[model samples]
Target: MKLYQRLHPGVNLGPTDPENHEEAEEKIFGFWIFLMSDLVLFSVLFATYAAMSIQGVALGPSPKDIFDLSPVFLETMVLLASSFTFGLAILELKYRKNQGRLALWLTLTGLLGALFVGLELNDYRILLTEHGAAPQTSGFLSAYYLLTGTHALHVSVAIIWLIVLAVQLATLGPVGPVKLRLMRLALFWHMLDIIWIGIFTFVYLYGVVL
Candidate 1:
């Protein structure tokens, strides 16, 4: 908590032992490298989507036909809320050290994530069954499925990771390594939130308006 201190690659994270801090710096730097790679991957998908969205329908259902803004907007709000709850959980651990409250927040975050996935799946169901817009139906649908599905897959993985970490925190009591892991997970979760914002804007919102 020193002035001009940097803690665990997050905002307002508490300091750790020197040994752990040094190790965390290395690991978090590596994590940054991984995130950069992931950014490149998403960039490619976005480019692909942009290329296909215009002419890809080819007699299939267009974005206007398949996209329902209401559920997507709700999903966006839920995910943004989950990010806020996760931030609360981290700050709780940093300052309050209340394991129960921290776990509660984690649970809430996971539930929100699950809700997001469910909502997306429902949208998929409607697109496929009601709108007859499966991925194989057109290039636009294919690209849309690939991009959004990849993101949803990432969220599912993160939720599983969250459960694992919660168990570790309960059993391991937030030791140095565990806190470092939590820091990495926090970065990953926040990154997903950012990516979803892109999807919301570029895919869903643009699909509707443009």
Candidate 2:
């Protein structure tokens, strides 16, 4: 209820009893802490990636060998575009007073996101089968799987969340609680964009140059 009060405009769900905002503020603080914890997890995984990158497998394909810059770059563009679209969606929700625009943009975001996932999965399958670059084939492949696979898992979860949020908008019409939750989820989606940019630059681009 505190979240509902703090975030929603003119919809103070907080208690008139003068004890509600404190609880909401605490929940917001806790959620931020949780977000930080997740960031730490990603940082550790990135460190592991850096350590294992140089230690390639003896007979297996390395990142440069299996990674096609064109496709990965294209996937990056798609995700980036989706992030921008989601931002627009949030803006429309906040002020334009139109749930339809928000929902339309979000649906577009989901489609773009799903397309990127499809391309990645296709690339992975090709690398494993035609290129013979399975995870067990090399340390590089193992790290590749660990890093990209984790990102893919997060993308899948976000897609599911997007679908659920779409339904909420469809039913609830971006009224109160759902609007704030959607904003948070949009932020989460954009956060993934930040991580993907890091992966693209460091993991893919740097690997290609190396």
Identify the leading candidate in terms of TM-score: 1
Q: Which stretches of candidate 2 lie over 4 Å from their true place?
A: 1-29
Give Cα-based local distance difference scores for all models.
0.87, 0.78
- Give the C-alpha lDDT of model 1: 0.87
Which pairs in model 2 have colliding backbones? Answer: none
Clashes of each: 0, 0
RMSD of 2: 4.7
lDDT of 2 by residue, 1-210 (tens): 445555433323343323443443455456567667877877877888887778765688767777789999999999999998998887777657677687789899999999989989998989978998888887777887888888888888999999998898888776556765775677678778988898998899988999
lDDT of 1 by residue, 30-145 (tens): 99899999989999999999888998889897787778889999999999999999999878876688899999999999999999999999999988888888899889989999
Count of backbone collisions in candidate 2 = 0
Off by over 4 Å in 1: 1-19
The best candidate in terms of lDDT = 1
Candidate 2, which ten residues in sequence have the lowest lDDT sum? 9-18
